[model samples]
Target chain A: MNTSSTFPSGEIQRIKGCCISLPGNDIDTDRIIPARFLKCVNFEALGEQVFADDRKELNGFHPFDIPINKGAKILIVNDNFGCGSSREHAPQALMRWGIRGIIGQSFAEIFYGNCLALGIPCATIERRESDELVESVRNKPLTEWDFDLNKLEVSNNNISFKLSIDKGSLGMLINGSWDATSQLISQGEKIDKTIAKLPYLNDFF
Target chain B: MSKNTLYDKVWDLHQVGQLPGGSTQLFIGLHLIHEVTSPQAFAALKEKDLSVRCPERTIATVDHIVPTNNQQRPFADPLAEEMLRTLEMNCSKNGIKFHGIGTGQQGIVHVIAPELGLTQPGMTIACGDSHTSTHGAFGAIAFGIGTSQVRDVLASQSLSINKLKVRRIWVEGELAKGVYAKDLILHIIRTLGVKGGVGYAYEFGGPAIKLLSMEERMTICNMAIEGGARCGYINPDQVTYEYLKGRSHAPTNDAWNKAIKWWKSLCSDEKSIFDDQVNFNATEIAPTVTWGITPAQAIGIDESVPESSSLPKNEKAITEEAYSYMGLKAGQEISGLAIDVCFIGSCTNGRISDLQTAAEIVKGKRVAKGIKAFVVPGSEQVAKAAIHDGLDVIFKQAGFEWREPGCSMCLAMNPDRLEGRQISASSSNRNFKGRQGSASGRTLLMSPAMVAAAAIQGKVTDVRTFFKTNSDQSSKTL
Candidate 1:
């Protein structure tokens, strides 16, 4: 359903190592990392704050207290994930936590796009398949989740799902190119023609 | 292709062309940007060595990180300053209009567009913020886009959106005293559940909707996205036209009449078909508050937390989870949870009427010694308007902090967050975990007047108590 132009040009990377399984629907931006962390500019430092609101030290059972998920590189989740306010930090905080990929029934519209644009693959699967991953990971300790970026395939024996990564996003993840201007510049001719057709576009002209 | 309901008409009118993969490349009439999401998009532009394709179509503002308490430069947090600088540079380089810190127009993105007349009926608006649906109040089709999609809009002024199912929410009746538009929306979300509106655009209508002032209708539409609807809008009426009249960005003279004509024609016909329909009586709704992590986990102040057994079997686990996470007991009265803070802000409830209602509640009494209370106007214009009405003086004399406009304590974007384990009585939408800023902070959603009552009692107290105790409902005096 996507073209090569959607992603960057390069070899794709695959997910390797342990994954954290959060079983819930509609885990939102405010819950991913509270707005308190939005003040920081360096996305890399936001890892510690991922799901900070939910991880609030409480009842002696913090979200971050679970060691396997603390620094997990992949996140296997349930249906309709990331459904709430459109804070860009939601994906930024997730990426900071070294979560390279997510498997879920579905992702929030704005959030899915944000994650993919930032080189994070938010894969989609049926609810049953996603639940299987959640159950399997929850039962096992530090289980490996392997998702090949090139093949757009996720497999863990218990469940496997094909991903639909947009072309521009695919290219960026492979080459680590997230510069927006460059992405647009490469498609300059198309943009120029579109702008040229509308007299209103020439406020800058 | 479709032309019956308001949704179909608006959609067909705004369609530029269809892109591949069944997504429509819908043209945007207006684009609003805030400090939080635009930096990355601007960086993408710089990388391409490109400028905003249509600068005038886009408007920028600083909101997410601009402190309501402090407006000083080179902020205490270096990152905030840098991000603000990035937006400033981007707006300048691309010839885009930016309402920066301390600007007369600066406020929350949703609040500014309406006041400045940037958001108009029969137009399509897009923002990198989810609350962009707030613009849909004026009968515009507004969508919240991601940073990459923000890039797309800067490049094309169009968004690739999936078609939505149109749902007609008909509410008819006269609302009781103290029942604000915020309560109406909260009540709807409570009945429908948070995900009920997924893949839909709510067409808010019926006599009760038409009777609401333009600002009140705006408040209703602002929370549509919270219910997972693509957007929520009301049919343009005399109120809508009157509100738009003579506004700075509104069309002038002949253009204005033509615009209104088109806007009127876009309203749903009496028998216009909708994919779904729900009806409600306005009198049945009471001032609502959420006691749990989701907005739907709400009960009226007089009601008790529903017992877990009463919920469907599938919903039990989440119900149990919410009960534990919120430290709330099943069957416990939702009216007495101790509160540490009371905030009146956010695009949802930070309107002038909200401030006025809250001011009336606080006019004669001091805030409980231990309880912290503050009011953040939704926009600079709202702030100025409230000040003109002397609402700020009432707030200050009553011991509540009257701060500048922005989405303060409403998702914790600015400094107005909670301390550890602090429970807040908030007028903002959403009662999610740590939504008020503390990792372990708790929020109790309520009307602004209810928040004022809680501030006075330092607990989840009834707003009716203050109403009776005061013996004055018409005017507030310090």
Candidate 2:
């Protein structure tokens, strides 16, 4: 199933693509996008710098730099992916790098929210499932990997495994409510109603 | 139902609504914006044709990219100048208050907020910078948001977020001499692991936190993000109220009495229960410094780094990575490792108290011949105060450059950068590889006083030694 939808008003129910696996725990945001790239004025060019330093140091042999993994749309990472920094550029860069979905053992809190806001689904699987998925993607880069958000399952032709996304986050993904800014605007009256009672906020009024 | 924790009390009060998901729509009383993350957000707002809903609620400044060495217009770096100019334009366009350089109001975003009394107890604060948690020192539930979230806050003045579990970190006992709030936080992060605070709001309290000054509390809360917490806070008490009494934004007279009453009521009730509880002995903490890439990989001043085999299985790989990146063996002692640069600034430890502590250590001493040592105040106000106290002169006499206020060398967004593989003694929060700008450079995170001690010796020296040395020198002079 295609993961991306029409801009600003759609849900990401499923994602299907070839996977590029990067295995390591606590793979922080610094490794994901590096701090230097954060100086840019916008998010458009971030994709080129996603893991730029790592790719450079590892040269042509790095997974993302390897010929087979070029343009791989799904990334499978180990535990605690995107563990540091509040930079949205990390997720924006990953998305710009052509990744539509991520499956890992876990993700940092802010990173997960940032991804969901942009219609990028970040799902978590059991350690064994994660290991098998990583191995499958690494050994067979051409194999189609399918992630079904509704079913909470990921599958290749040879194997299938159940993954977990928090129920609330899952609802947001399925129902297209993840664009929190819109939700926030729609609830403007509710915010005003609450603010009316606050002593501190009342100062401005 | 259990009595509400401090986090619960503050959160429930600020929560605007429950969203379609289980997340709460929390109203942000204050939104702080800096150059690096905000220009894109403002661009997004322009794309959406949206005006800031509550411009008065937002405050803007040029920090992440503003140079600490120079305060002139049209910054040296084109990109840096562009970023600052963009921030200026955005703030002016949106009618948000801009604390620009030379306004005597600008500094590091986190540093300037509290000193200006913009950060207060029981407030729900959001910023695009992670150290926004620094304001939590005032008992506010402050957190860092991404660029999109910044846009959201600017447009709506609220954020949709899942409520976090509250973890009460109880620190008891008096701290030993030379072990400051920085050491305490480093020690806490070391013990709990960097990811330990994930999905939790750390409610720091007990005897130790209670005794710390407001600036020290800010220093501790500033690095809560380093420990992976969404935010951290201390319940506002008499010390907190006293610190806010005469500040610019603080309420006065009858309004002050009313605000204090409300603030007092927001403190966690004695019967409040936390989702998790951890205890630390202040005396057990030493002057600490990070030896590895992550803040959690820290050791005591006199301790050696852990061997890979000695570490837990889950920690071994990262340890190995740190070894390779830092170009040091696993079991080597962190001290006496020669440092090329010493930075005494950042929201984490760039306050007046932090500078005072560092100045005392560097008094009657000169920095080593090869060391590049400098001090950057957290804000222009901090700079003016330091100059008035002659702390600037003391630092300059010790051969450290006394620079203007900004986030200098903290992330090296400006010209203050580490070249090649030079090692740094940084008072800033993160020590990630290349975090100080150069690809292969290394950073050892420590307190400002420890940094001062390191600059003088040209190596990592325990700050307590310098404390004794300075006192002895003074006694002799007298």
Candidate 3:
């Protein structure tokens, strides 16, 4: 799917891809990638297992199993997407399955942060707009969508909808600053200073 | 925009610097790692040629994949064994302290930290597990992080995180005899929707909170992630100091007194401002049970499932999905719904007190004929304590299997799991679809005592009906 096995990296200012809609609120990480799949030491084998249970339950009737939805890179979802379990496996599985971006009514804080760390943009829109987008995608499976972080909107040739992401996250996504380890490591002096000043670390002396 | 709150004070203290992308480089005072989420992070460190900045501050434990029944070397499942071994190797290689199986200290990361007093006030904690919020009960600013952020913390002892607004959740009045902290938190989640705390940290305060024990407070904060809050806390007080006074990692001698003074100072100021505030009457919260997939889809034990037409338009989709998946009809009473399994364990409600309370309910009663019931201690220390108190004996005599500690049945990553469409009365934090192993397995989340009561009757019966207060001990008959 998508013919690209390379992991996402660098600035992610825009994501243009055919969209797939997954409707339902509070679709937790367990449903995304079941706990049984997390037994692996590495995340390499998780792609094929994304929504493994849900897909199996639906028996090819699920949106992800539909032939037309194959190779879709953008995921459209409802409220509180990725609501439970801080397991980054959920987004890692989705990303491995070719989802470069997610548009949802809202996202859990940890899930949103996990997506950002992997360079996946999670943009939010109003419930009405999300419903309309899901409807549009269902009416015309595999509708191409252009999601622009700079413009804070998602659009096709005929229709457009505004999107919202925290300004800090937006800036990081566009500037490739989402990979936060290097930046944090660069502030070595500041971290040392903070640690030295902590009361608990010093035994309260 | 909250001011003078414990969150603000802790965030300001832990602020290492400002990052280029407008996020704060916040120093992590404590970094916790577990088998499930830390392997990739450790591997990332190797890939980047980086090392753990503060090895002493980071702790590791094996929980998620450890089998409760047979925790012998080279576990029955090779994958699970490999994960645990990888974690052991990672901890040893990185010079990080690890609490592995048979260590007596090993248990669920969230449960072990507080019991050992590694969790403290005015500290910032981060773990890859979502229930790391459990540390917030000690007045720490603890939250869950993804593995990438875990790598950041390992490499730098800090994270580039955006600050969160603080919401004060005030609950007045004391809880009734049968209602526990689990019920109160479930009620809170039901009242505020799961995503209500998406962008805010919750400050649980008020008289009702003050009345809870340290373990009970941990129970409330452990499920903060389930309520969509990255962190939840109650300011440290006399109760907090008392709990940490004699633990292994707590301060000694004069330092203990000094720590108390500083911890007390970290409480939210009387004049502190909050981004949002909500209030609930603790007495109003009954023994709550989840009827749907989400933690928010809960109702009092006496209430019935709401009809789809009665719900808001936005809720109809998930509600319908829940009704169909759970095999429950609309307007069905939750009380008499049969349960095939009863599990009492997790970072949420697997503490010593949770076990003691549940044991009290099933002390003389046998589990319903066909029901498979068990109790899993959250950690080894919890199991030890429970055994010391003879709670494990009570549990076993009541037809419940008393298993070893480590997140058993909570995520069902271990061998313990549900079969087919079996519905379980669980004290775990989540009730998500497929959360308990089987794709079609069902879970009804409640307090440990409620789960015990369900085991006795093989249904979702209210714990209140079976619970007898100390004053009514002479008439203690289920």
Candidate 4:
């Protein structure tokens, strides 16, 4: 089900290997990378700020100073994993943070599309299954999620889940293409041929 | 199969071309832009030496990065100024209409479009911001796109897309007193678990929906994205047509009647089939608030936080995490969490109705000391309307900062923000960690009136109490 085939180029990227599980919900784009960091065009440095706002100590207490999820490829988040405004850089930041994909009970539609375009697999499961996955990871920090690229599935022994992706999103990722402008430009030859046959597109050109 | 919902009908009609892979080429009828996401998209076009294929289908505005306090030139932030200038250049270069700040029409892109009637029934609307779903109020199939997709629309006037399944969310019974459209959406989100609507478009219908005004319907559809629906919409009806009639860009005379007929045709039939169906009793909904990191992690104002013991082992862990992060005692009533700040604005509940409701609570009272409260109008027009009615002065006299319209503290790209671990009773969409612009900040989502009440009491309090028996003998005499 080529979920990554039809997007514009560079929209779909592949991250190989096992997964890391971060099960927080409503982790917004700001914490994915603080707004202060957005002034720069580069997305490379954002992964470090993945949970910036939460890392601060509360006065003297360790408020959210937990260690990074140690290179988990796949992230299993709770319901509304990417809630809030549409910030495309969010998935970019998370992708750079090395999260290859997300499996939540739900995702913000725009963020879901952005993730799919960027080749970050976002899948949904029932709340019960999501809750169970959330539990499995908490019990074992080293829990590994293995994603089968061909099958488009994210699973481990304790929790195996199938993903639901729209054909365009799935196709674009699989084909490693989404920068369709350039693709359109490159398809000039084929477009020219098709247009010539149709005779109507001559007016548009 | 049976008759199709508006969602399915619109998706089918907009299917320009379907590829073998299953994703369809979806045509967009309108494209709205703002300064933040457009500069890069335009730059991409320049780099490719491509022209905007159909500039007439697009409109641009400046909202994000526009300071609500000051409108001076060459902004203190060089990047913001540059972005603004770039947007100006791009709009002119491509023959697209740009609404700059302070331009009577300058407003949040979401608010400006519908108010202008550029968004209509059966049209596919796309913007770079997620709140584009606000246009669904007019029964348009709106979706928030990305910067690259923004480029796509600018160049092609269409989106390469996959389709979504349609779900019919039917409501029965009338809402209880004091319940607004905001409460209805919250109830929907709570039942759907934020992610339940993924891969689906919600068709809101029923006696309750039919009873709502267009503006009230807008509020319901505005937050559909928050619950993970691609978009939620009511089928166009007399209310929808009335709201669009005589609007700045609405069709006129014979064209108006023609458009109305088309809109009516797009509505779902009584027996429309859906991928799924859910029903809610509007009377059962209550004014709700978010307690933890997520919108779903909340209970009604009358309910207490669920004890961790009742949660599953996994939820128990997150509950502990939320407890530690939010600094709240387990099982404590969510009603009186001490709030240090109050923010009343956002694409969600920052409309004129929300402002009017908040002003009702703040008119004769003062914001309690030690609480910072402000009301940022959703758009410049909303600000103008509020001032026309003297609602601004009522708020200011009561100690709420009356500021320029923009997506203020909602996401905080601009200067308005929260400080430290201040817990804010906000009317914005999300209550995620640092969502209101401070790393250690905490936010509780509520209606604007509830926010006003919190500002007055310096804590999360029931809003019904504010309106409850306020005309009593002694207090009224004073």
Candidate 5:
């Protein structure tokens, strides 16, 4: 895990860290943090349990268990990462484990939204680029890279690859709008107006 | 862009405004919460010094951590008890209506909302559970949100979300006698792949979908999340209205007539445009089951598991993982595979109709020796209806345990769970690695009737044969 004990706050434009690659398709939330670990009322103490079952089965060979990948802030994965369950615990566990950004071939919708809500930027690259990035990270675990939300790209001293993120999410990340509670509450008048217009709220009157 | 579809109509109706980031500030018509995901959101609200904006629009229930067999207060697990206590305290403090245990209204959040008539046509629903898509069966635009979004909804009664492209999945022909909505959805997920529906809302239509009852439609929509769709919905028809009429929260008398008239206008227009469209023949779908970890890794009952060499290169990795994880070889027949346990309950297939159908198959038969089988109704209301119709007795007489209402053994947060590497035939949405409690436990996704049939034979048997046998016995009696 990262040496810093505090979580990120405010606008997040750039994330610089070593990357950890976990290659697979349809790696679900249940795998990231098992349901048994979800009994807690808070997300604290979840970082130690992320990929708990898989790491146990792999017996220290799992990417998250490898010593060199320690404190890796960027998680590189293959297609359809986080495919099942809407437990934000999946991303929470990853975030707590020092995953500040994620680059994958694709992401499941709810998982992507969850990451954005927590101020973690998730970007997509083509399959070939994602494969090459995972390879480079696995081969050179200590190489530092920068993921730029403003430029929508990941780059090191020797190589760079463009990333793709939805405009809404990209805007939210760079402008600190991802933590949506304050902004949503600021529009209280419009909210009341919309609720007033809804037929069911008035019992179809 | 999709135009004039039910998704389009409902989303437009709920738009509070456009946010600065181009996402819509969409108002949530109904917000459902549960013990597992709500406590943290409530705590976040307290941290922010905020309160629930519209308590009447929000509902809470305890299901994920509630024991199916023993639901008395002060649960055996202190963690579970603390979570429930936190939710109760939060709801009471905020004036949010909570359907706790023994309330007769308490059950799985997804199951109770619809039965109480809180889910309806042309509304927007948000819940902290992925199966919140089940409410989409009422023609509502419902999305599963995380706890942070839950906190946002508590403070503002809305979500900052981007509009999704709509995909109309049109299915023709009727399902055969033994095939059910569960099998059909499994087949769709298999054909579409788990990621096919990403970034899109699925509009299920055509004659095949219309033929399914409201409960069956809910079963179909409940697993839409497993296919990677955030939401799935069917346009409301007479079936939808009939299911909601006379329920606790539904409009009454003159308001009911007006509601129906408004709902009728919410269907997609004849010339509606869609982002994409796919067609299928329901008659061709058989009793499908998942032999692998992912819901998309499924096949018909008669087919054998595909060899990894024969599968596309993209699917090989997960296929190999599934082969080792499930302890099955490539080309092994799915039918007749021995099952150690049989479970028939979940948000996906735990409704009254689901229970009744399974009970019909197991009425005069007994569960096979050494096979542990049980049936958990989806909600208290579902349990009451099942007992009123004698479905519970039928299951119990067949040597199956009839348990109380909760999400038991589905995700297995409660005491009911699989042990060791035991393989189970389950009627739930997911069969992910370690989804049913045990780290190495295996699960096969199938219809509830298929689960009942498997329980009788102690293996994965073809349910069509059982239906034939029942018909033959009835003919003899006649």
Candidate 6:
């Protein structure tokens, strides 16, 4: 499926790639794409700076700097990934860095919404399940894993486990209904009618 | 029929319709924009050949990267100047009102709105900045959105979002003398883990919240996002109504009573059911500060940084990471830690009252030698008011640089930043690593008054000590 297609036709049913695991929990947006990098007028080229400071501090020992993880397409994170700041650059940086999907115990609400907008499906598994999956992925580095949206499952051929996602978000991922702007535009007449009835808005318009 | 929660009342009133994916198409009553986040959003609109759906409903300002020292054209930082120019051009092209530098109306997007009476009760507000929840103090349902969502709002004047469960956070009793609203919020984030409010809208009420000024309430709701809430609000009351009265955008004369009546109705019903409930005693809260990266990793002024081994299982790893990143020893007392800088401004605490409180502490004192301290008001209005009341004189007398109104040193988008390994006593929200510009910089979040006390001592001295000294000196003079 072409997850990158704009509005209406694109849908993502599955993500297949070797995963790179970042074991930290509460990995906030500032860490994902630090505040200083947010100064740009546009989000392009942000991939080069994703975790820029952290990578530098880790002295090339970080997972993202490791040669084996260079082309990794999936990211396995711990609980509450993307927890602070409403900056869209966090997800933009990740996608630009070639990460196609994320699996974690949980995600910040706004971050979850942003990923859906960009067609990045974020699935959740129980803590124990996520821990085991991450361990397996680490043990057999570069082994391809499949995360199937329709079945809500992740597998590495030998081991498999079910995951969870809100039904609405799952439907949007499967059918490509995450193009909320298109839906919003389609209902333009209704919105106009509603705005006309708002007392405060009447003065402005 | 289900009794409506505050979230439901606001959500139902503003919802346009439910989309195919079950997300509601919510109309945005107010859309706030700033230079850092809006340029790309406007560029996205240009990419699609779309105009702003309703320019009249939008307000633009330059805050994030605007230098606070000199109010001049062609800033020394070319990128900052370029960003401001792009925002100005976009606002002019779209016919949206731009509160540029020296405009008097210009300030932090979150600060200027409420000060101008543009933020009101029962409104659904959206902004590109995360602290947009600051508007929730007036009983509005406000939240931060991404650039993509900002583009969506600019094109359609609406947003598609799923409904959130309501959590009532009941804070009771009275705050101690030196403990302020910033302390209260830090305490809340400390109790509820960083992600505790996921999928929730926190309804802050009870005697303690009701007693707080509108500015104080704003400080509380301002950092609600730090606790992972989608948004946070307090029901409108006499305090809320009084603050909105006689403002530029608020209704006047005959329309005033009608507006109040409608706002009054927006409050959650006494017997309304919440998805979850939590209570905190105001008396139990103390002057608070963060020692770790996440806002939840906070302790009272008299408390110590938690030992990783002593932390709960889920908190151990982050605690260890924070310890290493901060270069702080576990179990070390938060007090008496040397600080290199002190900042008193942000959407979180850069209000008139906050400055006034801090000024009272610094009135007859001077900043400790070798400490870099400064105060930036939330807006031009706040600066003008502070100047009129001699708060500027007090801050200046104490050696704090009185700068122009903008989000200076809050996130370090401007020239104000912590140089390598410099630790700061800041009034801004969030202590995340590198949040204040330098990769190795450290931040200790606190109230503005606490920041003043720290500036005087060059360390995390308790504000209560200053309070006692001030009173004793007053008695001697009298």
Best candidate according to DockQ: 5
Candidate 4 residue A32 Cα shift, in angstroms, is 2.0
- What residue runs in model 1 are displaced by over 4 Å at the alpha carbon? A1-19, A53-74, A116-129, A139-205, B1-3, B468-478
DockQ of all models, two decimals each: 0.29, 0.59, 0.86, 0.28, 0.87, 0.59
Lowest summed lDDT window (length 10), candidate 3 chain B: B469-478
Predicted candidate 1 versus true structure: per-residue lDDT over B1-478, tens digit per residue: 2248777876775566544333455667789998887877777666766567678889999888877888888877787788888888888888999987677888889888998987877677899888888888888888787777787789767665557788989998967777778778888988887778876889899988988887788888988877777588888889888988898887777677667777787788976888888999998877788878888788887899989898766467778878887888999998878888899988887878888888888897889988889999988889999999999999999899889777878877667788988888888877877677776788888788889988888888878777666566545554
Candidate 4 residues lying further than 4 Å off, grouped into runs, are: A1-15, A39-48, A54-80, A97-108, A122-148, A151-168, A182-205, B1-3, B311-314, B474-478
Question: Evaluated with TM-score, which candidate comes out highest?
Answer: 5
Per residue, candidate 2 scores C-alpha lDDT tens digits across B10-116 of 78877888888667889998999988889888998888888899999999888887787776888888888888888888888889999988999999999888888
Q: Give a tens-digit lDDT track for model 4, residues B81-130.
A: 77788888889989999888778777778888887888888888899887
lDDT of 3 by residue, A9-91 (tens): 88999998889998888888998999999998888888899999999989999888988888888899988999888899999
* Per-residue C-alpha lDDT of model 4 across residues A91-182, encoded as one tens digit per residue: 76676656677777667777777776566777677777766766766677566667654565667776676666555666666776544554
What is the C-alpha local distance difference test score of each model? Answer: 0.76, 0.87, 0.91, 0.75, 0.93, 0.89
Rate residue A96 of model 2 by lDDT.
Answer: 79
The DockQ value obtained for model 3 is 0.86
- Per-residue error for A51 in candidate 6, Å, reads 0.6
Interface RMSD of 4: 5.6
Writing each residue's lDDT as its tens digit, candidate 1 over A1-205 gives: 1122432223348877676777776677777876767665445457677776456454336545575565566787765678787777788777766666777766766687677656677767766666666677778757676787787777666666666565545655666554332443344455455545432233212
User: Number of the top candidate by lDDT?
Assistant: 5
iRMSD computed for candidate 5 = 0.7
Instruction: Show the lowest summed lDDT stretch of 10 residues, model 1 chain B.
Output: B16-25
Sorting all predicted structures by DockQ, with the top scorer first, yields: 5, 3, 2, 6, 1, 4
**Chain A TM-scores of all predicted models:** 0.78, 0.92, 0.96, 0.71, 0.97, 0.92
User: Between the candidate structures 2 and 3, which one is better when assessed by lDDT?
Assistant: 3
Error of 2 at B113 (Å): 0.8
TM-score, prediction 2 = 0.97
Better of 4 and 6 by lDDT: 6
